[model samples]
Target: MRKEIHLEHSSLKYPLPEQFVQELSEELAFMNEYPSGGSYKTLSAKLAEYTDIAPDCILPANGSDEVIESITRAFGNRLILIPIPTFSQYEVSAERNGLNKKFVPCLEGHNYRLVYCEEDLKKASLIWICNPNNPTGSSIPREEIKRVLDIAPGIVAVDECNYEYLGESVVDLIEQYPNLAISRSFSKNFGLAGLRLGFAVSSSKNIVEIARYGQHFRVNKMAERAGIKVLKYLDYFQNIWQEIARTRDFFIAGLKGLNIMVLPSKTNFVLVDFTTEEKARKIWNFLRGEKVFTVAGWEQEFSGLDNQYLRFTISNQEEMSFVLELLKRFPENTS
Candidate 1:
């Protein structure tokens, strides 16, 4: 039996659109052709329509991870500043490029909120802020984001992978600050994780520079077709997002009922801190033994700081209920 339930992966638990699946099946014929180089013309235009940004301002990459790497490469040798316990990719990308990394812990005793000082921002050549931050699922307020932008002299990259869950965005601020860039992904809301599609929205100048670092025909041909198909079903995607938000809140409430300390989240997952590390580990093992996968806080190198902290993703109500029921019975396994 597999030792893990693979619950740490972030994406919708629901099915992809039937139309998208069907169209993708049909578009498999195009796999024989090479992907279009530079900006994906059709997909870029479709994204432009969705984001209300010019096509030239978008740069598509095989995945947002690649987009991050490209940004790190282009900037070259600037200090990368990040808030603690955010996405790991930012630090990993910086290390891979031999760039210095500075981490300022988010608001202590305040659930990891963005709390960097102006001096911190001034020293950074690139600042990566994950809106609706990963692992913690806490969002830095828009006003705080604006404050960071105002003081930072370098480029600011906002990773909005979970933005749809929050229903807010800073994309509008792009025009106001030439140094700001927004990275978005199709993996989360669009259910396109397997397709590995992501893009960056920024000033035309920045987009052009990032595009130069991107490999030719890097995006798979089939993924582009899938992207175009998914864009047409935007309504379906929106509906799914609403359902996810509803279920996520319901699940969070259930966790609270069980006395698990859940951090407030605008993202699709909850960060739960168990009262004791022993309890957290025992419950984590019990859930895995029951074939219900969840993320154990110890799985990541940075996670052990809080042995009680576990990250849980919201799927459907039924799954949430099962997880909650198991937690309610946690006392039985505590011995």
Candidate 2:
């Protein structure tokens, strides 16, 4: 049987908009026509309106990965700076491009949060940052982000895939800093992971350069309609996100009660350290036996965690409560 509880990956587990599902179904008629590729014009305008950025500065892609890949292709010739234990893909991308890469660890004992040294900041060409970072879920301060922009030697690519909960953004900095690009995802916030839709915000000149590597028939028509509906009822979506954040706090508190060490987070997930890699694997096995799914911290991207953590994506309160109950019954490791 399939896993009964899914706390794996950072994707939102709640249902997508009912109306969007209907619209996506009805809009399937446009399947015969080609997708607009990386330059979904109207969608770019919608993103621009939502972000308060210029349409010419936005590039809507099939997914945020496309936007990131475009960054690698456009600026792959230089050194790339990445924060360790954030997302593994940035390292993979850098390696694929044969670009020199540096993985800077955050301030000592900051739970793998982002911290940059001035000297290290001046040595790279492209800096990759994942706010409310993926595996760790640690949110770096806004001022620190501004500092990176001010000091970084070259382009800084900020992946704000989980940006909604922060209530503040450096996206506005894109216009002022031609060296910055902010990539956002609809998959997590809009509940559109199935569509694989995302967009990027940057200076007009920066986007123009990224768009040159953009290809055709990238975004599907149904996904486009769903994306439009999401923007149209954005307030409703925002409210839903607020609820998720509330649930996240509740889940963190519940985990703490179980003697688990949870990293602070402003995102929909939290990193729970089991104090040791062996303990983590034990709990992972216990949960897997119960058919609940979650991310084991052994992933190389999260090596900074020393395989001692688990990243649990938040679901509804009911689902979370059930998981917590199961975890309560977990045998304590005295090892």
Candidate 3:
């Protein structure tokens, strides 16, 4: 049987360092004890070292998902201004917390920029911006985010879950904008997606406010150990991140070479436009039959997309070349 190729979730194709297993093995003995609270002290200290921020400004969580939920629970009382064709979790969290939301048509004909009026900005109590956005894999600049921070009435949450791949951040803005909170994950760069380790970075007061909604001992012992262990190997992961970005560019080029329209991406995935929903679905079905999988645009739920674009996660060179070959074999414009 052919090996299954999963390019659905935009996770890193790289494996974790061997030292991670040894660290987790040592942690197994301490499974009986409760971990420190969600704002784990040791993990927070390490993250502070990595981010060059104060330890009090970090709120460690099970994953960025929990951080998103907590942000909504803590401050999602009024309307939330969400730019469409972005991550669905922002909307999911808003609905779960009973907050009214306004979706602005942002990504179409705009080079995937975040578009919203100052009136909407003033009325919003919370705003979610996914830097290096999901599905579309586009990024808005820090200045754009700074503009939102200036006018928004409440918390401005920036999801930097793909920051490692993009290599750009507004983390420094947290000190200047007390209402700014950034959520990051170890899942992508560190290959710890299954381990569920992520954190929120903000001003000390904002971190404290967000931590209230978190469950006591929410982070597992093993996950915490993995997070701390991985930070020591940033140099190793830095090299991997560069390689992944290069692979993503090459993959995008390969798709373009085949006359496919792919939105420029700063993340580990590309949004491929098949001109119409029919073509997108046909190729999607074809790839699945070949034991390859990708995320369909409609599957994203928040994209408000009708073209049914396909999002392909970039893998290693060999797998990417194989996918390119498969695309070459696909009979385009055939009934």
Candidate 4:
């Protein structure tokens, strides 16, 4: 049997620099000490310098996963409205916290673009929207996001884990709308997924309340040191983001040439539709045999349309080319 490609993986396929590794090694001496109670203070100061928000507005967590959990905990038992086919964690978090979930399914014929009408916004106590949405890799327009924020007075969590690729963010909107909270992850563009560090940017009042739910030393000491080092090489990070975007466009164009229908993506991944579920499964197995992995389509209550779609991440030029070549020779196994 061929080894299966782990489609659930969602991080950049790059290694951290030797310098970053060295810095992490130096921090090993402090590993025995507990992380600062307010883990976000120094990290937040650096982020605030970059985002122009006060350090107090930033709340660091073990990962954005924990940040989502903290928010759900803070707003317990409220009706949560999520636009369907998004990050599964939103639903998982809601269920774990005993919050009721109401989903607004994205229109199938319309490539799953967010259809957040005023009525949908009115129904949610909290709304989680992924800009450059996951699995599908489509981005909601900035104006549309603002409209949702305006219509929905409830907490709106914008997960911008893939924000570096898109170069658009609503971080500035946090000051104007108390209900808005933006989640940023060092995992994606920064290549720190294993480190599991991320932070939420929101108003100071909201941060204070959310911080109450978060543990004093939620983030590990090593991850904090890694984050601080990454900040120092911010320019290098930007260059990598640009390279990923370039490679993404190149790969999408190649997919189009092969008649593989791919949605326009603002993130590092592309969503391609296969002719049938069996064909998709065959391609997935073939890729796995070659050590290439991508995300499989959601196959549950939301499986009415395009159960054959697959999500592929953009990597370095050489690896991306190899994957594309392998895709070009993909066997026609519709059975």
Q: What is the lDDT of candidate 1?
A: 0.81
Task: Provide the TM-score for each candidate, comma-separated.
Answer: 0.94, 0.94, 0.96, 0.92
Please give the RMSD of candidate 4 to the true structure: 2.8
lDDT at residue 291 of model 2 (Cα atoms):
85
The TM-score, computed over Cα atoms with residue i paired to residue i, of candidate 1 is 0.94
lDDT of each: 0.81, 0.79, 0.86, 0.79
Give per-residue CA lDDT, model 2, range 1-335, as digits (tens). 54498888777777766776777788777888776665788888888888898888888877798888888778756678778777777877777777788878763554555677788778777888888777777787777788898998678888888888776678878767878998888888888887888887888888888887777656777777777777876777788788888888999899888877788888888888788888899889999899888887675645344587788998888888888888888868322
Ranking by lDDT: 3, 1, 2, 4
lDDT of 4 by residue, 1-335 (tens): 54433334668766677787888898998888877768457877887887778888898888888888888777545678777777777788888877898877884743766687787688777888888787677888888888888998788989887888888899989889999988888888888898899888888888887788888888888888777778877777888888888998999898887777788888888777886787888888788778887777754322223568777878778777787788888856312
Clashes of each: 0, 0, 0, 0
For the record, the alpha-carbon RMSD of candidate 2 to the native fold, in angstroms, is 1.9
RMSD of each: 2.3, 1.9, 1.6, 2.8
**Candidate 1 — worst ten consecutive residues by lDDT sum?**
297-306
Task: Name the regions of candidate 1 deviating beyond 4 angstroms.
Answer: 1-6, 301-305, 332-335
Better of 1 and 2 by lDDT: 1
Best by TM-score: 3
lDDT top scorer: 3
Clashing pairs in 1: none
Displacement of the residue 74 alpha carbon in candidate 4, Å: 1.5
